[model samples]
Target chain A: MTDDIAVLGAGMHPWGKWGRRFVEYGVTAARSALSDAQLGWNDVQLVVGADTVRGGYPGHVAGAAFAQALGWQGARVTSVYAACASGAQAINTARAQILAGMADVALVVGADAAPKGFFAPAGGDRPDDPDWLRFRVLGATNPVYFGLYARRRMALYGDTPDDFAQVKVKNAAAGRANPHARYRKAVTAEEVAASPVVADPLRLLDICATSDGAAALVLSSMSFARRHGVDPVRIRAVSTVTPRYPRTTLDLPDFATDSAAVVAPPAIGFRASIAAAAYAEAGTGPADLDLAEVYDLSTALELEWYEDVGLCPAGEGVKLLREGATALGGRIPVNPSGGLASFGEAVPAQAISQVCELTWQLRGQAGGRQVAGARCGLSVNQGLFGHGSAVIAVR
Target chain B: MRTPVVAGWFNADDDPDGFRLLGTRCRMCGSVFFPRADAYCRNPSCAGSELDEVPLSRTGTVWSYTDGRYRPPAPYPGTPDAPWEPYTVVAVELAAERMVVLGQAAPGVTVADLAVGMAVEVVPGVLHQDAERTWTTWHWRPVGGPV
Candidate 1:
């Protein structure tokens, strides 16, 4: 409820296929963040790293990997995996440490040296895994679910293909100003339309690409921040909540949706669940957001995020887009960091990167893409396997 | 093949001729769940109550369709030695239950012939094979189109 932890530094390894080890990228970013905070790795009492399953060995137990990479000094190590939300969990872990007085200063890191082509699950025959069942049985890639949600919006709310394209266009323009963004060239709706359709109603460009990258943050208690003569933007709340069962609206990798027959589903959908937790903890609503950095895996998803974040009503998402309510100069700007729409998928680093964008924006340091006079910010992203990660920050 | 009642609804001893989708209906709330939620009712508004197995209507409208141009990973039971052949996936909205069910389409049915809102029916098929048996699953087929 209180804004107590100070975010002293945020840094990222530019997202793209560098063919380097994930540990290398994370160490680079961690050192950059440490330098940004004018501290040494030894001063960091805790280090948290987001795990990337696709990157093999070191990725699975990322906390220790990064700690070893940074030349371990016995910082407490913990590894938590929640698919894409791994980075947020890492951040949450470090926040808990600083908040509980477990440690005065903590380092959080997430990095991924991604595989080429479509993302896949670890090799195994585990019927217990729903993600595996969907791929083996339905071949439903993540984008397939995104397409389904997009088309469902069209069926229920009259969202057009053009409406979806506009999200990419806006984000692409903003991405041009982002030095760390993988795709820096501005894109047009026509370019989006002309791109090959990977899934019906969504094109190659409509979906974020696969990239190898890393992101890290330095967090500390208020006392630690002042002791170093370093000022920090404060982190007000972090939401690592999960969905209530009867997750009726179809989610990725589920063969059949949770039947509302067993019980009435929650009034809010999964993304709303993420934002709701942040709002409750921060004691603020969507109207209070100066800027937001959301997980825009696909263009249509950005629109869905608009409604889920409560910037607009459920079916009125496209209407909000149409009127520029979510654009750069709009009343409540969304994905002003250019979003995942331009950054591609880096798995573990993506969510942490969302926070990095906000930390920069909150400090008035996000030069070209800065949300004008921003004071409050939030990052909203849903991880696979029901983990909802949202963080609210205020200056 | 010993098929799971859940797997049977989508890809198992798929009796093609009498192809019926399976689901669970809450006796208390009259709401339905695809892939069958036999344990409980999903409507949070309804007090947790009894559930009954129900056959979903064989016919539903196409909500959307797409193909995985790339091969999906493990737990799907495909062999890397074999050249990857992509398959189409469909999401159908059952008007009867107001739910969207997802499944693979019958082999060879491309996205070319499918359109949103077109009527389709559920049929059964092989999901994967082992030395001993074929794992069955359900496939959605467009009515009057190629099988």
Candidate 2:
């Protein structure tokens, strides 16, 4: 145990285009998390907010925004932004404070109101900026990258579109049980094939959507949890790792793949590094993981995670999924509370939201969609730029 | 005007066909890098290392491929006056190096024709242009024939 930082409470304002200010969503989830912890906003000794690029500026300073929304009482405040991994980074920051005894209680919140259509790089004509150059020169969208992976799978392993569609079917069934998920009804493979093609070899169902939502967590010292009359599920480790040099593979919105200019990159992939850091810190391995919540931006990416996370050997991910090893009641179920497949990305709020799902499962509080014995759980997400996040939680 | 040969990235290209992507290997760690990291070694396990520049193989196998279906957003700097022309992107796996590299597919290639595992070679293509000069970049072309 890395000096268990108690999760006093977990909260969310659901996920979808609620059409409200992101601050409103954060405050709502904040109040809910505090109330669930049986503590008041006034009780938090520190505040950390995940930034979400407010129009014309980087997303608002979430710490002060939430503090002011809840009526500030002069708590230590911090703001962080790391694209998609902002939420997890926020949690990590809060954990550091509590573990260091700088504060006995803290609040962590992440919220975002995403823009429509494909995610675009910031507007500018800088030649050095690869994000803009890729889009301007090649016209690649996020789906285009997804399509490349899907096609590669077909070429290498003969993974049919039907195989990709089945991932949607399974995740949708789990999503139907998650009230917090945006798209709830069950999906079928035929339905997935019927959906319009967003990119070659990938369909609308294969890609996750952008959404507006907020999630918040109340974290505190173990002593603080005991003081609150709760023996809470604790966060064991938070992995916020970055990719090694020569990020050789192509990612979304980048013009040229990383140049192998100086030194060889890791044989272990970037995604694997996210999980490896968590497992090392949490003192656990894939064999000990009961459930895993990974960023499934595309179905192919999720299968890649299965291999990177060590749930299956490389080139055997499709085999693991087809054999029911990662299903609802299988040996090591994945995304038991639905997944990004059911809930489109809400950016800043997502990494924290993964923790919320793990917390629910670890406590045996996840009803209907519960894994039989989910004692230890892992959450994984990748941020744009160089950010990545993962968390390990235990009851 | 003859191209500047892009320095050490490729052999001095009097002909555009002479272009190839350049990379460096850590003399100390034996790790390879592309786009030519000239300053220092980046191996976490290696010391501030002496490096050697080496031209990468001109060919590899296609790992996967896709084509742009829509005009991309700005900062990509396509003028409002230019008609949007979609292009293909290919992820190529070099078995000798055991690494996957991505680049634009050569002109006229589309997703309909390219297959994974097909042999392809890297070649130079114009990235963009202004009144003064044209920017050069790398592209992958199908071997034998354009599919």
Candidate 3:
């Protein structure tokens, strides 16, 4: 497709609790990506940085911050913030610029230095902010929402805690070989069961942790890749879609779902629509996918994504998991890079890291966790508020 | 001594029969918003500026439920001085409004005690108490269960 852009290189700073500034991690990732592309700093015409709220004022202007840290080459810069989807937004912006001929070569970077324990909202007495109100009013931490979804699945589809624990076990086994993943040990179902419950039905090991990490990608116009005499992985589509009105689903930071009384609900739910738009743009479906990197904020959410991404029918996600249809050497592998189950969450850096995993897998460079004959991969994640994104990459 | 944790969320007075969550309904589109949409109607198709405050339906089916095993972080009003206690949370779907509202489960209602599609009703309860005031909030309880 004419809209496609070549992914020249992808890189990441290993996820962990490094206790460093967000900028430092970003710079490390950017330099590694540039080197992988076999290009110097001056070769990059644009720099797009995914913003991190925890980084103070510099985080807000991340584009300029990264450019400055990389020793300003006068590269045109842009910064975007959409919570967890920030990295995907950065990638989308870079792809758009490359296709529009605004820049022949672009670098997209995202990184975060997260705090310990649960992520709290910004300091304030402002009652107008829904994020703050959820904490103050209901004490609804992110895990609470995860627990709600997990329990609902159990009630509706007969999913058990064992099924949820199996997801962690599979992902952790894959993560054991991934150098960029934070937790590299193979986790057992027994280990997951032994972990304390953070939220009812969701144990400590079943939920993703918050960590410090960074990811970067070097993208170029297809023509630019041709000039370099390289046939690289190309980004087929990036869908950053918002939910339609009368959102019936109760998502994060909100205490209620929209009323479907007046306006009828959308034909497809929000998460389903995200991947549908990408499939429509890429002219491909789940059958064509070699691998997927769905956001596993909680083990249960990964099963939900299997349904949302059209890998299987609704209420059949657990069945797919039970049959090993989603494990490595199965019909289709998910989170071959171990996903958030191993890497934890660095917020802004997360979505970009998914793309990085896709790049490595498609290039056949993913070591022990490689999916056989991987030709195309998809990455999907949902952010706070209404932001959701899915990217498809093909070799 | 009872003050609402967040003002205007519910009718916090001591009348149990009259206790109901307040929300706004759009005049032009009939769209309802809880936590009150006082500024303007949120419906994109409707240009009507009037949003009337209305009390929501008290009873609804349990869409889902969960409980916190650990105390939440700051702005949640928990202190190290007092031992932490886990609390159950419930999301109830109102038939009249065609929406789901979330609140704490009434004291003693655990995740093991609830199931999906079980009917529950909103009731007034205390969230936390400081030296001077007992913070008031809404809780959901099974319709025929303990008071």
* Local accuracy of candidate 1 as per-residue lDDT tens digits, A105-164: 889999999888777766676665777777766777888888777767777788888999
Expressed as tens digits, the lDDT of each residue in A76-180 for candidate 3 is 999999999999999999998888889999999999999999999988686889999999989999999999999889999999999999999999989998999
B58, model 1: CA deviation in Å?
Answer: 3.2
Per-residue lDDT of A151 in model 1? 69
In model 1, where do residues sit more than 4 Å from their true spots? A56-60, B1-17, B21-57, B61-63, B70-86, B94-98, B107-119, B126-135, B142-147
The alpha-carbon deviation from the true structure for residue A393 of candidate 3, after best TM-score superposition, in angstroms, is 0.3
- The prediction achieving the highest DockQ against the true structure is 3
Docking class of 3: high
The total of clashing pairs for model 2 equals 10
TM-score of 1: 0.89
Better of 2 and 3 by DockQ: 3
Q: What tens-digit string does per-residue lDDT give for candidate 2 at A164-241?
A: 888888889999999899999999999999998777788889989999888899999999788778889899999999
lDDT (10s digit) by residue, model 1, range B32-120: 76666666665656665677767887888898777776666555667878887777788887766667788888888987878789999
Q: Model 3, A361: alpha-carbon shift in Å?
A: 0.8
Please give the DockQ score of every candidate, comma-separated: 0.45, 0.38, 0.86
Residue A114 error for model 1, in Å?
Answer: 0.4
In model 1, what is the error at residue B146, expressed in angstroms?
Answer: 6.3
Lowest-lDDT window of 10 residues in candidate 1 chain B? B5-14
